[model samples]
Target: MTISIAHLGPPGTYAEQAAVFYANWLVKKTGIEGILCPYPSIAQSLQAVASGQTQLAVVPVENSIEGSVTMTMDTLWQLDSLRIQLALVMPIAHTLISCATSLDKIKTVYSHPQALAQCQQWLEMFLPTVQLIPTNSTTEPLQHLENDITVGAIASSRAAQLYNLPILANGINDYPENCTRFWVVSEGEVEANYRMSSISPSHTSLAFSTPANVPGALLKPLQVFAQLGINLSRIESRPTKRSLGEYLFFVDLETDRSSVQMKSALADLSIHTEILKIFGAYNVLPISKDLI
Candidate 1:
């Protein structure tokens, strides 16, 4: 059966690129083809999975430079039984592109709203508070412009080249450590990382909240990992529907809990926390540098 996977945009959106990246990787590994479904928003992508219309969906959970995506966090909170079965990171390389003559004459900068926000520091430093226009996605910043030499768009190098836009500069994002981590949500076993199956099963992500909603309740479980030398890849706080001040913590522990240390920590944490759910344990493959 062909796996139906969801992402963002029609094509050339970062989420779509990520979905294609892993889908192509899967094709290379297992010779299994996938159907790529591009949704208009992350919430739509989540709904596709929730309704069982797709086998999996790739959602950006966090960006190395920009921090967690708050919308994705809110969606996860709304999804009760949804699980993140696997995760992978992709390097984000932004470029200043134009269809016109020179960067010196350009008067405007256009890009996906999030992309523009992420590059605020660099823009202020270089563009000198120039007019910035936000497009729906990075891939179409050029399409929104008036197609003149006085305006330029900041987008991926792939985006520039694909649309015949000349790249004025490469590696333009403010942070060099720019990588977006994406979650592959699914109910079936992942056939993508069978080569590293043994090592992959040791990493797990869990979401929980404190019963008392008291101070230090959330940090309590983290201390257990510190004492046991369990590495936490990422931690994010989301609003819990229980109350206005209440929150839920989503944490990723480096080591899978088959070990005595992990099992003990889970048992203790469960006793103190209100809701605890293991998202999944899967091997995350190393990401490659952006080819642009």
Candidate 2:
């Protein structure tokens, strides 16, 4: 059966790039055929999988330059059926695509908010007067470039080539090492066909809510991991949305969920949290520069 993968699109977005990489990797590793399905928003892409419209969804969870993707985190928390199957770290290179003859001719810039923020410093230095507009995806504004010389879009070089647009500037991101981590998520248990060779130092993600916002309420759950010597790679808090002070804490642990230490840690952790969710344990794949 051919697996269907969902991602943010009209095509040429970073999320789609990660999805394509994972789709190719799936074929190489397990001989599973996959097809790409594009959604207009990250939340909709994830919801596609949750609603059984697709088998898997690749969504951005974090960025090295801009930090965690709140949309992915919030949606993942709300959808209990979804589980992360793998993590892909892809380097991001922002390109200014336009029909303008020179930078001075550009008056408006368009891109996803994250892309715009990542290129903030460079834009201020070069295109300071251009109006910065945020779109649904990096590729959304590519179509408008040809109609107006004053309009430019911040997207990938691949996107420029895909749209057949002229690139006015390359490597426009504020940081040279900017990258985003995406998660291949699916509904229900992880299929055996999706498994790959063991990649060491696996990560397990989870979320939990405290009974109340009392002091020591959050610390009690954290201390469980500390006492067990299980190091946490990330910990972030999102509002539960039901109340102002109530929150849900998301964490990334450096051990596999099936490991003995992690099993024990969760058992102890549950005592302190009102509700707990285990996202999944998965390996991280770094896309080589040559591949990007």
TM-score of each: 0.87, 0.97
Flag regions of model 1 displaced more than 4 Å: 146-148, 188-198, 241-244, 290-292
lDDT by residue (9-72, candidate 2, tens digit) is 9999999998888888899888888899999999999999999999999999999999999999
| Local distance difference test scores for all models | 0.76, 0.91
The number of the candidate with the highest lDDT is 2
| Candidate 2: residue pairs that collide | none
- Residues 1-292 of candidate 1: C-alpha lDDT, one tens digit per residue: 4678988765677787778777877777777677899887888888788888887888888888778877777776677567766678888988888765666687888887778877888788878757998876676556755458778888777776667668887888888878888888864445544224445355778888888856778778888788888899888888787679888888878886567778888888877788887776665654687522
